[model samples]
Target: MSDPVRPGAVRAATLTRQPAFWVVAALLAAGAVRIAQITGRFLGVYPLATVTAMLLFALLAVPFWLFLSELDFLEREPASLRILAFAWGGLVATSVSIPGSNSLENLIAKLGSPNLAADWGAALAGPTVEEIAKTLGVVAIVLIARPQVNSVLDGVVYGALVGLGFQIVEDVVFAVGAVAQAGQGDQIQPVITTFLVRGFLAGVWSHTLFGALAGAGIGYLVVNPDRTRAHRLAMAGLALFGAWASHVLWNSPLFREGLGDGAVALLAVLVFKGLPPLLLILYLVRRAHDSEAAYYVAKLADLRDPVLITDGELRVLGSGTRRAAARRHAAARAGRRGRAAVRRLQRAQARLAVELSRDADPDLRHSAEVQRQRTALTELGHPEAVEGDPSWRHTVSTVGTTVVAVAVLWAALSFLGNG
Candidate 1:
């Protein structure tokens, strides 16, 4: 998955000795302190609205956190580093961008006229300042923990978390701002409206998605040592530009103004601005995850131990879809415990692959764990080595899922149209 830091590669400077570690640490601390002050003031001024905003965004963060953390299941990024990336976005990037975007917007007004600033300042300045700042959160991870970022998907996960952090905090600020503007006396209607519009409607294509696009570039830059440095840098630059352009378009009213009034037109504008990047990021995630799963599953195949991972299981292990189908098959065969056992076996097999990659099994540590999981499967009469559902079943399920997804999309769009 990450040939750049393969076993026996030249070791980077250790964390204690790296000056970049201290620099990042100092910046994070300062950002946290500043954010805390601002949050304190916001609460003091509008306790109900502030609390409502925080609760809504905090709940929203859970699914994003779980999904991103699990993207690279074969070699999941460590929790601490993921949290660090989020903090960098929530605390550091948001803190910097508040003043930075404002300053840049003022400069634009001075140079291009107030009318220009009013029309385009947020589109230009916010993305310009915030994207760079959020991108640096990924950079900070690479600088501080180079070994942890050995996959493009790693960058995507970290970037998504950072963007998620920024998004939640920025949205809270905006929710409060909306409250202040409404002069609603700390009522929660604005907070709820903000939650639906920002956290529900636009959340999927907002900062988190942008961060992931940029993070994929950083991951490529770090992991793909086979390419020329110039070529790698160019790809990374292109990814970042794509992220910025997507953000600018999402923020800009230039296109929305032409879409005219009414919810139908507004829905069209939202889809036009958001859908391309959503598709792009989905494609990237699938591509990266499949490549990673293949690499690790191959490692498991080398051992040729059915107890650890059977041939049937090997086929399923390399694909997330098959893995899920296998679990469903187990549930039908046995029950709830059977489903759980199959899941455990799959996870154990994946972990064994990770350990096998390093040849660090002098004592058969990870192998023993896989065997234990296998034994549990045996007890439950649901061995981890069953052929998955037939191609026809998969085709039916795929079509069913697509139909459901389309139905949901139509429902959401109709709701927005009615709004």
Candidate 2:
């Protein structure tokens, strides 16, 4: 729905430019300082290799981080606050969660019960505290800027980014520590190998996916007010269970044997345990996308400008890639104004979908629907001409999903076999 309290376009435009400019400038300055430090390093430090490992870990993390950051649902909040929340998740949340869990395990062990430590680490500390701490970013976002979280996926994306941040920092620390502890004059190859395996292979299951699953539960609770507290609690339980199970399986002694045995066991576990939940989540996302598209299509039916959007365009918008392509086409033809209009229409449709999913008072929902329709109509200008058939979206989504599934399966197999 149209936010009656939407920021003035002029102010938003000015603020938008500042983020890009500052981010670039900051990155450049940091890069320069890092290069100088590395060049000045002494013989004891393999500065070049250390820097490379850090950079590689960061590079490995960028795709996941960018994926989470690109989510439009988070744009409502002040950019600085959002960045701070992510940084907090990466640094403070991770720092505390890791050492805190370790301390708990040590306490359990010191109590002359090592088995208890292992059990608690797997069942409680790993899932309960870590998942909550990782997902605190979503909580902060919701409490500080409630409007930013309009859908379950928004929470998932934000939480996943926070997790990715934590994973990257943790991996870099491990790599650097490995080299430092290897003693003076030792080869850096082992540290490099550790970086590759941890940063690339195992990183997917680290904080990112755990936070995503937990965030999904939290998102369901925040957006679905009609759900009873008991139901919300159950959802939380299921999410934590999933996170813990995944972590436990990944860290299980079964993998201590070699990659082949580990791969077989892990594959069986993932198929039975992991794939179903992820599939269900994907189904929910598709339903939400379709509902959003349908609402906007219906709302704009009465517009005098019949060319604002077509059934074909609505179909295209039902999938992520196609929607992106459509926006790019519009921007290329009609400039920033057209792109902004498309974004507004998309956001209005998304908000309308979220409202539809809720059990809000009938009058409130109806009013929201009306507002969304009006906003959509106002923003949808002349439709830009684009090439390719409408069936392209289905093809794209199918190919993209298949590729991701295969890649994930391969990674799982590799980790199970190698670990």
- What lDDT score is found at residue 78 in candidate 1? 74
lDDT of 1 by residue, 221-267 (tens): 99998889998999899999999999999999856568766556766
**TM-score between candidate 1 and the true structure:** 0.91
TM-scores, all candidates, are 0.91, 0.64
Give the lDDT of residue 48 in candidate 2.
Answer: 56
State which candidate has the highest TM-score: 1
Overlapping backbone residue pairs in candidate 2 total 3
Q: Model 2 compared with the native: what TM-score?
A: 0.64
lDDT of 1: 0.85
Q: Candidate 2 on 113-196: residue-level lDDT in tens?
A: 888776555544555556667766666655545555555665566666667766776676567666677675545664566665
Misplaced by over 4 Å in model 1 are: 1-17, 260-262, 360-363, 385-419
